[model samples]
Target: MAQPHIAKVLVVGSVNGHLADFFAKVKKLDARYGPFSILLVVGNLFANSDDHAEEVISLLKNEITVSVMTYAVVGDRPLPRRVRERASLKSGEICNNLVILSGQGVLQTSEGVKIAYLGGRYISQCLAETSNSSIENSANAAEPTDRVAVDPENSVSVDKGNSTAGNNEEKGTAGSEISKEEKGSAASESINEGKDDTISDSPPDDDESTHAHFDKLAVADLISQVAAENEKTFQKAIAQPSIDILLTFDWPYGAAATSPHTASDLSPPSTQFASNKISHLCAAIMPRYHFAAGEESFYERQPWKYSDRISIGRGSSAVPHFTRFIGLGAVNASRNEKQRWFYAMNVNPLRNISQGTSAPNELPANCTTNPLFRFGKIARVLDTKSLPRVLSAIDSSGGGNEASLSNRGGQGKRPPPPLNYICHGCNQPGHWISDCPVKGQNKRQRSDSSPPSGYVCHKCKKQGHWRSDCPADSSTSSGHASDALSKCWFCLANPDVDQNLMAAIGEEAYVAMAKGALVAGGSAKDGFHGHFSPIPGGGHVLIVPIVHTDSLRRACEGSDNAGADQRLSAEIDRWTEAVSALFAEYDCAPLIFETSRCLPHVHTTLQMIPIPNAKAESVKPALEDLCKADGLALAADYPPAQHDGYFALRDPASGNDLFLHMPKGSKSFNLELGRKLAARILGVPAREHWRQCVVSEDKEAAERDRFIAAFSKHDFTR
Candidate 1:
């Protein structure tokens, strides 16, 4: 029964050491727009070189008392290194009211507005480290960063010779102690690592390059730290994710070209603003409101609508998703002091908006040809996957014209659709892709759309179809997005899903107690009734790999070489030995198994079911008989381990276990067969069904505590 209520959010441009000006601006706004909640500050928050930066900091700590909660993105020049270390190193308090918004940082206001941030312009990490020389001498962060970002803008007035924001500082804080292993730390470079460096070819130490390099490096490092702390949340969001207000430090590359805006209308320096990475990230996040600062000009686009291309559900809708992007001008660079404008956004629950008579705040998307010329390069120097092959081909031409390919944006340039392709069903302005109302007129209409149905969207506050699943339409789904981690089970890749259920972390793997284990304690006194009692078997833990991968056999298939694969194959053996050791310590037998359903995520699921030696002896024969009945090869002896009906199989010679699936078919069939045979081998008829094993967190934690207490020495987590 939750309904949409209007919440106002304010966004300010840069505050380049002008903390007093910032406080003044918010005060004036409060008098005019008295009741706004979140205040987003873009541009350079703490001036790296400003002598008065300390005064500004003091003002923030002592003078500023406005209740409108504020968050600032790291701008062209990030906060002082001390400040960056404070925010990134510990996520420490910047001030009582204003917090520095780093990557993955969110500010939840008292009035219930959640603002998410992904800041710093796109820059390559190689360019950042190689050129800056600080990372080369010794770049070890309390917060790890391997990112490429643009140089700080020249508009930032700094001390005559000071390196902007610790680019070439080559020193950590005094008295800070770092171990030998942590010094000069480098991330395992993805295959795409050197692609961005190809553009520069040599280390460029120019002011522009250095500024770009430092901002991106710092921001990326901050982001990595934030992600590490919230590992469970970020891993889960690889699939469908929604956010309310998303803040970026720069306008998304090519975003100005989406509607009637030309390149000149967005920013005068559009030529220097080519970033396929930023553009790709903004598009992927799908936020309701996207805001950016440090642009040359100010722009507030009408809400733009887009359709979900890959409809995961049974059907789709043409009432295109409503997303708005706003750009605020630099506070110092504005034409007039009074010309600077802060945007006010209204947030409301989707249910109230959908039910109320008022339509979504929309503007005619002036689909016009943009006149952008040269721009920044589209980087493929981050990850190997999803490297635009066609774009790579264009860049390889060596014409030095990255803008030629930037025009297409992420989806590649095709001419806009013919204007005549209208939706005949809805009679709306835009042509429908899948949102047409009359797609199936002869079929039964959805009963849940009626007002009197008394239905509410479980995801959001909308009365909609019971059969339909909806995305977070406005990020107004009651609880903050960061707090809503229950929707996904395994997608949160870290071992700390719950503090109690986590047992130990291995070099590349971790252990967690399975919920509602196959055979565990029944009840506290009565024993084995349901989700209430902990599983009695002490070794029923899941061996989870840290990386997002599918099958163990195919994890390094395309990426690893022969030697790498051999090592990886050996790690599988080590994992098996670890589980075997755990069970043997308690005089039990280890029945480790793995299976994966084709899901959006790549993380593989491996379960270690420990049982009595007698039950364990029956498993091999039970699996053999079940495979024979299903016409599946004996899993352990099967030649191919990565086939469709995949389940874990051990190789006798190498002692390495790989997933063995039936040659072909969906994974579910063989997985079920494997689980059923496993249950039969263990002589547990009730636990034969996978669905029945799903249990509450408390029971899982109880089992986890026992394992943790027994095997505390095996913990290898960073």
Candidate 2:
């Protein structure tokens, strides 16, 4: 296969009104990373003062030469009058090669890279205005004012109308610089300012052409437009839309904390300015590369993974996808010569990549799980109505409906199943009755009174009888027993199982250290002082039943021999108790939870995390809070009588066992809910997902050895 064509691109930080210097640097960068396809500016393109007004006018009039196609988004500073006027034109093309992307929309480059951008800082007024506007009005609301421009004088007011006065006043001192005494006095005044900051939501004056914030409804409308375009191009609803790049002026919430780099790299005030709205948008879009530039520092986060599988009910594809986030620094504003003002890279558009090949071959060891996974469902809900055709198609196929379970049990009418609903003949969701995979084979078998030429029984490994009809052994065929034992990650018989992480082996169950333990292996200071002095190798482990069962309920009820079933349950319970006792020895209590799904070929495992004794009282309330936030009902019942799937939590500190029963055929129950709740309670929210806490294989082996040594005395099976 031929290699995909790579587009060389440059992403720069704030220009800060130094147009001449910015262009000079770009020229040099082009020489080095040569003949770049395009340039993206994320921060303030123009300075607040009029020092570079001439350059701005020159660029607007196409007098200055711009070698590569350049696009800039609105930043914190107000745009100059001339530049704003030029950008307000229909095309938003300020010069021959330079363009200002004034509003929230998707920009597909000549190279086929789709860039979804929402420029400008978020303001509450934009959302309020959007709520009152009609869909048609919202779609047409992408104006020059949509870019957030903060006035230096009235920093509190986010309304674009308020900036007009400041813009007129700044024109008077255009060519002058602030005196040292005045600068010091201004700094002192700002430091002593009160905390009663207020934003104005008054309607803008007719002459006020500049706006300070992008409308939330405009972003939703943009997504709807993209979905419509995709349907026309591909003739199907894609569950996870592919965006090559996403550009925003403000950083997404938790971007710094979830990254491998410390949040300390960014100033405290900058980190506090991160936007939750941006986070939700990023989650919904799942962009391959996200770039932001509001902070004073430059930090490139390690790549993070997000699920790319098509949601075709059960047995979906297992392809992996990853995203990289880079935050650049201000241009010509170097501190100790360490901050990176620009970044260059080669990128291949998602559409150009071959079908079977992964765009990104492998994830780095430091890669983290999707940080925005928690907000994905909520984001999708916010724009469901706007995407009528796209979402309707998804609902028909049972793909993207996170609330399908709720809809089914409610008084509302259930949605009609897709035309290509699960094939009864093949027991799969891939095709309809007329196009079943085994239709031809069944006809040939009947005529010849024997199995078809390509027939192969999966259960008995014979030529006769379909795999589903094979009478070799009912137990062996049920629950996908043979397939589960061979391919399951938790089954010890699988060659891929990480034996190095296995801490202990029992007759009916086994215990292994979690691949990525929530807690670090060291003394816990800061709040956990006396309660948990030292955490031994994260103190996180998984207790798994040796039998390959989908759920504990199945293991308990699906067996012919009641005695054997009871023993299996008892052995798993014993392992949990032993792990709890071991953690208690180190002044820690265990929070064990299990997500038992009624799906085939699943190996159930109970995850245990040791929390500091001092923080034990807060665990129950935290779990309850998560349940409420996620719209889950918490029941006081310990073991549910129904054989349906459920999420059960055991809080040893409160002596309370709570369960959240999932409706049958529900695919929206978050399997990582337990880990997320635990991370919040432990005050380490970044490690909610195991991928964020993954370490080296050597480290895993060492931790396993330490856990085994400590667990030896409590080894009940031995």
Candidate 3:
């Protein structure tokens, strides 16, 4: 009876009742324990009374085998009242093979005194529960195995080779007894509870599946929230100067299924119909933005930037409204480093700014009334697919003065120049249509930005010199020294002698020439002759035809025509009429007469000069004044002084000797007319013959001789 009862009264070793009691008292605290391969229990179990100990052991043995171990000192009472008293055990009752004790000297036994310390035996189902009691609870509330068995439900095999005849029969009966549903439901409940507990108590898993679902959900939710919040913001923004909504989606975000997917498989939020559908849906619900998912980037990792193309009033934030077009690009992502909020916005408020108030930092103010603004309209018209219809509409709407469909700031009175996408006028990349140099002016303020390479020679299609700087190309090169244009016939024979060499040069040198040449050209449409005409006193009515002297001589001497004189007269007449017609049609002023008889080949005659610095409002009146003095109506022949102003200034005392008055401090005494002009204008003295002279240095003589020789080959003078 004692053996069977003791087997039922199993021990919960290593865990003391005091510790368990303390844990039980603090049961409200969150206690989390889970399946682990190792467990270290630290406790003294001797503090519990025998009755309590017996009860605890019963609980332990119901699920697992039990062992009783004790660590007691000799000085301590052998049995306290809190635990079983020494009188309760018989003298020889202590079993050597059953319990383990540490630091024991002796145990009172009926037969003899014996030593006991740190010794124990394995227990075989000492605390095993009866089958009836284990299956008493419904499977719904059942727990996972508590004994840490490899396979708890199939525990009959844990003891190894010893065959259980009764266990086989028990297993057969257990299998037949339990239905599959019962096991499945119990397992499912255990797994669900484990998962829920894990999620609440532990760090979330960082698996790919988890992140993918999270990202998708987050993006969708964010889109919805942003749309809702910004809808009202967008409405208020519309009443201000400019209103543009930009939507960009990173590639590799959607379209993952269309093809064997790589990073590029993701398209930008499609500007196509599908994207518009999304936008429309959003708009219908909240009116958050006008458009979403605009055109995709032409390249990966790039997005399109947009401008409204509006001409907002000066000092107003309206410029952004009209400049709205997309700039699609793939810039390096490295540019994102050191980024800041309010990056390009004006931090200061502009409440009291007036229409013409100077923009901060000298930037051009946004102006509602500017000629460049009107020029943008022309660009917009050209940009749209329906140019013809737009043109018709423009013509119907009073041609150049058409009221803009939108209140874009375009109160300009002058027409813009022809299309020039890359404007070298200001020596900067990304030119506006207005920035182009055309018809005498570039709209932007000029800068002294020079190309890395030197200027270029357009006549020879060579670098290092501009046409103005090419002696063989034009008279300007003859006027200076240091770097003389080569006089080889091939170089000299280039047809576009007067055309700026900078325009034809390599990009680097060409840009340099463009910068310098245009600056001297006075304006885009204006030639580089100077403020005064090449031939002074020539009025706006003069026909300034810039012709190559050699070409003129060839035309004069060629036998290809029936009459060379007649051809020459006709060519001159044709040019004369063209100039007149151009003036009348475009309301241009007049051409001046500034011819150089010295250069026989290609020499430009002063056609006309519009009233110098004519205002837009006064342009018509100035043209009227010029037309009233039209060359056709004036004397058919120019006066002798007009024809030969330079020779007219020759010394009267010694006509052939030409004892001319040279300036006092001339730099070089040169024979060329350009140097002579330089000396006269600069108050420099000369020191050589008209054909072989020097003003200040021999550099001038060398340069003049080079130019004269080059110009003479085409002079056609016998």
Candidate 4:
């Protein structure tokens, strides 16, 4: 058997012209973790002053010997004129072992690591400049040096921009040049030849800039370049190319939103300087690892999974992609506390790695939703299906109007829809009928102001109108209550309920095994498989109210009979107490939580998960920290006289109660907040989403049985 080959790579933060110290640290790291195949330097390579110009000149002239092949990108400062001139002349290589990839494109190393790099700060003016027809015509007239061509042997060819081109055998560089189809250049020129222009006489320089700011055309070109390379490499229009690493100078906007830390913790200056252009680029090129600098503090965001799009009936495989964004502190910068400036990892190229079945633990527990998904540009760029809808929406607003177009751009709020346009489906003014939230509902039911044919009043249980139209006494019927129990999966009365998951039945409430349990089944001696639960069957249980109500509080409040309300609330409390006692028997502590919403048709269930006794102390602080980071206010008291939704948690071991009030119409509140918090505290973050933790039906039945056996003695209902 042969051992698998792994490529070792090292990435460091801004060098800031500390060449001597940086090289010394690299040599030590190389000896310890490397003999690394390559070294990637992000952010500022040299200081703004002329103090280090001599050192840069010496290194560029081959006087300095670097232990590894070095590649650097332009950062916050302009590159030295001498070094830039030498690198451009030598096709991006400054010396024997050092190279400067100053342009925006992908570079594939000898070890097959595909790195996508975008250098410099963002210039907002570039958007306006690129939109100018005269400047665009002039740019089109200039000899295009950045055209991407396909190579038969290499599959793709790059230009002076150092795109996804093959390696140059003569220069020992990563990219090679290709012959221009004079026809291709002529076609582009012909399209813009007769355009009205103010500056058509002066053509823009064709040379790549070493300036501290990048042009918007370069960003668009990079996106198109990456897309073209994917088409060439995979031979499919929608195939996602695997980019191992992405290097950028500044952090992407909203990078700290989903991270465990807040923007203030990761340097507010850096956060303020973040760019949405970078965010758009990151979304387009979903790299495995994204490294950035310019921030003086080190911060590592939780890994985020890319939104998976359905395949377009093409033969392309749907592979899940994830990106881990790491912001490194400046090298040798003075700080109150020591921060990490270097990162090293061993990786196998995506081509070398198998694209087969992945293990259950493949995704990290701390993985989160992509922060860049909020940007609409990402949807327009990556999702071709949405293009028609977007274009139609824009066209309907006005005839080629820039103001109407701006409404659909980025994250900016749009003006209210015209009063003349109303959605017949929901009787709303903001959206078209086809885009209505209730579009799937029967048209007769919406327009007739009457319930459906089989409708029964939940309040009166009479066949006719809904609970809202019920003629029952106002005092007896709660205005907010609705009957959804007949269709609810958690309701025992539902014929479709999974009986195999039911553990115990009571007069007011019932106990059942949680579907997609966060914890795995095993004994403590078996070791932690992903969760901290020591009890068998993962110790995940759910207590559900037998009545159809949005929440337990609503069930109690809406009941006309006081006795029935008290009994329902007490029965739920007893079930929770019983489960806590059962977990105590196994030396585990119970973490019980519930989300009570005022919304109609919401089935409320209390989730009870067991954690190790040792970890119980850390749960409250972790939850509080996450809430604070997410800008959620946790109050010591429950919601006061509010019909809105609120989250409640009980920590019996710590004797603490916490509540987060979710006001009505607050779309920002995350419904999965509790599950995410529990997953993090229990060390099963990957299983936060119930869909990911679902097991087979047979396995679910077995877990239910095991839990019932363990809770037999503690079953108060029996």
Task: Give the best candidate by lDDT.
Answer: 4
Query: Which candidate ranks first by TM-score, i.e. highest?
Result: 4
Better of 1 and 2 by lDDT: 2
Candidate 3 weakest lDDT stretch, 10 residues: 2-11
Please list the residue runs of candidate 2 whose C-alpha ends up more than 4 Å from where it truly belongs after superposition: 1-5, 125-211, 232-242, 261-270, 308-319, 336-338, 354-366, 378-718
Model 1 is weakest, by summed lDDT over 10 consecutive residues, at: 135-144
Put down candidate 1 lDDT per residue, 1-718, tens digits, no spaces.
Answer: 5333345556766655556655766766755653554566766654434444545445434455545555677665445544544445424334444556554455444323345566666655324444333211111111111111111111122222321111111112211222222222211112234332212212334234433222333333323322232223223322222245667776765455434432224332341443444444444434567777746356655444443331111122213344566666655454443234466645642222333322343323542211111111111111223223222322321133333223322222334445776443333334342343343221122333332354344445555433123445323444543343333344332212333344554335556676545656433244223322222444667776644545665654534455645555555556667667755655556666666643323357677765555455566667667767756665343334333435665422244564445444332244445456556765666776544565443345445555554554343221
For residues 1-718, write the lDDT of model 3, one tens digit per residue: 1110000001111222332332232221112211111111111332223323443332222222222211121111122221121112311111111121212111211111111111111011112323232101111211211222121111121121221111111111101222234323322322223222111111134321100011222222223333333232223332222112212221121121111222223333232212211221222122101211112122122121112342223534443322111112111111221210000111111111112232211222321111111111121212223222222222222234433223211224334443554333333334333333331221111122222264344445456533333446443555431122223111212322222111111100110011111011123233223432221111223222222232222343354553644545455555434433433333333322232333333333322332222222343333234334331112223233322221112111122211122222332212233223322332332311121121221222222233222222222210
For TM-score, candidate 3 versus 4, the one ahead is 4
Residues 1-718, candidate 2: write the lDDT tens digits. Answer: 7544455667887877777657866776666555666788988787655455666655554556676667787775446655655455424555555667766777766555667777776664344333333111011111111112111111221222221211111100111222334323322322113411311122234443233565455445455645543344322344334467888887876565544353225432245346656765676666778888867457776566654342111123333566677777777666333466677666666555423232433445666655554334322212344354322211222233222122331112434448668654544565543445565334213334445675666556667766545676444366556665677888754645665466666657778888767765666444243212255666788888866767776555656666767878888888888888887887888888989865556788889888878878888888888878767788876345545678888876777787888755444456788888888887777777665566655466556656655776686633
lDDT of 1 at 72: 70
> Roughly what TM-score does model 3 have, to 2 decimal places?
0.18
TM-score for each of the candidates: 0.36, 0.47, 0.18, 0.47
Question: Candidates ranked by TM-score, best first?
Answer: 4, 2, 1, 3
lDDT of every model, 2 decimals: 0.45, 0.59, 0.23, 0.60
Measured by TM-score, how close is model 2 to the native structure? Answer: 0.47
